[model samples]
Target chain A: MFGEELKQFQRLGFRHVLLQVLNFASVIASGLMIWKGLGLITNSESPIVVVLSGSMEPAFYRGDLLFLTNPASEKYKTGDITVYKIPGADIPIVHRVLETHDVVKKKSKRSKTALTGTGEQLLLTKGDNNEVDDIELYQGLDWLERKHIVGKVRGFLPYVGYVTIAMNDFPQLKYALLGGLGLLALVQRE
Target chain B: MHNIFSRVNNVSALFSSCMMGLLVAIALSTLLFTADPKGNLNIASVKVFPMKNRRVSARKQDLAFVNFNITADLRPLFNWNTKQLFLYLEAEYANGQGAKNEVVIWDRIVRRKEDAVINVIGKNKYMFRELSSTFKNVPPAHYALKYNVMPHVGALTYGEAGRTLEAVPFPESRERVS
Candidate 1:
């Protein structure tokens, strides 16, 4: 197998190998561009996420794919599932909004806005399977602010995201996959 | 080009594209099911009681207890694409400090269509409290039954099933429940 592939590689010439590398790099770049473009359109840092835990079991399972959107004008309401990231926490949590308090901001001297209007929203979330609200998960904060939230979950696809979890669990598998893909791309003709 | 590797690659590529198209079509089909079910939600009573704070044992917080009745025919919301229904009862009110609040006092999950015909007389499962630690000067709250229809492989949809005709005022704080 090695001898045949080596012979074919030499036949393709150095220019063809360079061209293949360029093609692979462009494919990777376009994937990144699409992801960032989706993030910009949805107003979310990560437009898509994979559920790593079973906190939202029965509704969202581990390995499920979630699509998120954070519209600036919309106010999050109770019963809406939101994906929020607490400061100091490494992983973002997906949960339902248990409560929302839209506090009014004090009027400023320079600004002409009224004082009675809604300001930043304070949220409290809870898992569907949990017995109590997620006060302890706040990581010392009293309530979850709009800035802490990544986005509200808009769409879901079951089990499509398990590949990432599997790769994470087994690092060797990830390296093998990347190496195999790279090797295939480099040796393939036309 | 006529090797086994190319044949496998072509077949898999075609299979994945077909799968993508099917998933997209299924996601789009969820938009066509516009089922708005109506129901009745009545707040039987609301009482506030002073209780010891769980996090801060040194201080006491006023906890509001609400008893409500719900009768809603939510079967229409369960379509072929719907996996589960997340039903919740939320209290919408404004505090004396001009803060708008929406709190979910109780919730249930319906996984089957038969269980969607809801009829229940229940009390608040989660603690309902004001940020100020008291319900003092808080205005009357309007209770509503809202639901989220989670699809098996599509967009999540939400709607209100029922709402109280009038806002229910919070009763005076009692030292203890009778």
Candidate 2:
């Protein structure tokens, strides 16, 4: 099995392998560029997110793909679905905004620039499937501030992100996929 | 150049591109159906009562109870791409300290088009509490019925269906409910 592949590898000069490697690197670079570009346009750290849990059932299911946008000038409303990450929690949660409190900050010398603008917004979120609000999930905090939120869901696609979830569930699948892709890139002629 | 692997790759590439095109078409079709439906939201009564804070028994808070009637024919929002409709009743008010608040008191999920016509006279399902733990000195609140239309494969849309013509003032907190 190795003899034919080895012979073919020898037949292809070292320059061809270098070219393939460069091609692979450029493909990965373009992917990263697109991701970063989207983040910049949306003003969000993650412009695209996958629903990891079924907390918002009937509207969004597990493995559904969600597009996010975090406009700096806009304030979140009560009905908007938001994807937020608490300080200590590793996984981000997707929930609906149940309440919003725009607290007025006292005018001080340090905060003079923000005096004309709207005050800080404190939000309370709840899952659609849950019976109660998310105050218990705040991790000792009374309310969720704007900083804890990643972005608001704008667009949705169904079940397109299941591949990532499957790969996460089984580590061997990830390795196998990576290895297979790399092998194909190295061995393919065109 | 035309090996089995290359043929399979070409077929899959073509298949995936066609699938992507179809999905894009479906996503774009959501924009064509633009319907704005109006409804009536009537606030029958509003009452505030002092209650013990569930999280901290040592602290006391004021909870507002709202009774309202909603009549809306949301069937126009249920297009082919519409997956579900999330209807919420929110109370918008401002405090003396210039803090603005919007709290959702009741909500319902409409999954089928037949269920989109909503007519209900109900009370608040979720707790409605102020940030300062009391509703004293807070201005009258304006209640509105809003909805979010979730699509199966496209952008989500939101619209307001109804609103209280005049702000409804919260009654003084009574010591007990008879």
Candidate 3:
């Protein structure tokens, strides 16, 4: 009995373990590759965003997935919607630029070297359909600089992000799905 | 034979459980930190009123004027510590070209529970005088007005407080359009 069982054990050992490891590695690699590809194509660290609110109703809705692109040398313009992250804040904002002012002041001879720029780009942003500009939202942060922007929204698909929202809202479903899929994968002998 | 099948089933169960545990960890992380996608703020009302205006005749035989208005009744997102707010108002023209009339509206700051408004003043020729800052020298056309209200080191209650009031155009006949 022992001799026969030892031969059968060979069928269950190294090959099965190696196959599982390879499958997991491939999944991880593909995810990284896609993220890198998106970064290169958009010239932005984050190339996609999901609309988190209804501030832009009638134009965009919640759960909509927005595709973003930011060329390295590009400047923003009026009516362009953008996503920007503020320092010390975990969430990013989505809004439209209403106006831009290029302000240049003659530098005084004494402090000329200390100033960051002779001119400052002052930006005014607002949500479409919002009655007021975004001055209140800036929290006295003054003007939003070009460096604060993450990306500009180019296109959007509605309600497609609901699955992400749902999975977050109810975590049990997420675990159940994973468990079911793993079981299915493991049960197949071939 | 039964023992062999039992062992296979045990291995499968263990694999599934481990996968489920990892998935749960990921989901927990997402929930703990990521911003909620369901958040939204509705703008309900808006109103604007000119605060100051000085109408004068230019030496070149053209009319010139400066006006400031205070906009009021902007409902806020929540009852948090508000730091500051910014606003921009521009005069638009129908032809979208150089019409002598100009209205530059900008807000310095807005406080909590306070009405927001921008001050504007400019002068143009009499023909252009009739042209409103709403746009270049065209009547019945409106100016593009936009604003944003952000939090400054403050907190916004998840879904209850940020509903803004809609903008109601000031009645043309009112003495101070607000």
Identify the candidate with maximal DockQ.
Answer: 2
Q: For model 1, what is the alpha-carbon lDDT of residue B169?
A: 93
Q: How big is the positional error of residue A114 in model 3, measured in Å on the Cα after superposition?
A: 13
TM-score per prediction, in order, is 0.96, 0.97, 0.48
Writing each residue's lDDT as its tens digit, candidate 2 over A135-161 gives 889898888888999999999999999
Model 1, residue pairs in steric clash: none
**Alpha-carbon error at A17 in model 1, in Å?**
1.4
lDDT of 2 by residue, B1-178 (tens): 7789789999999999999899999999999998999999999999899999667346778889999999999999998899999999999998888778999999999999999999999999988988888889888999999999999898999999999999999888877757
DockQ of 1: 0.81
**Which pairs clash in the backbone of model 2?**
none
Scored against the true structure, residue A93 in model 3 reaches a CA lDDT of 81
Q: Residue by residue across A81-130, what tens digits does model 3's lDDT show?
A: 78887777687788877555444444679877634443444566767547
lDDT of each: 0.92, 0.92, 0.51
Docking quality (DockQ) for each candidate: 0.81, 0.85, 0.03
Model 2 segments more than 4 A misplaced: none
| Stretch of 10 with least lDDT, candidate 3 chain B | B154-163
Show the lowest summed lDDT stretch of 10 residues, model 1 chain B: B53-62
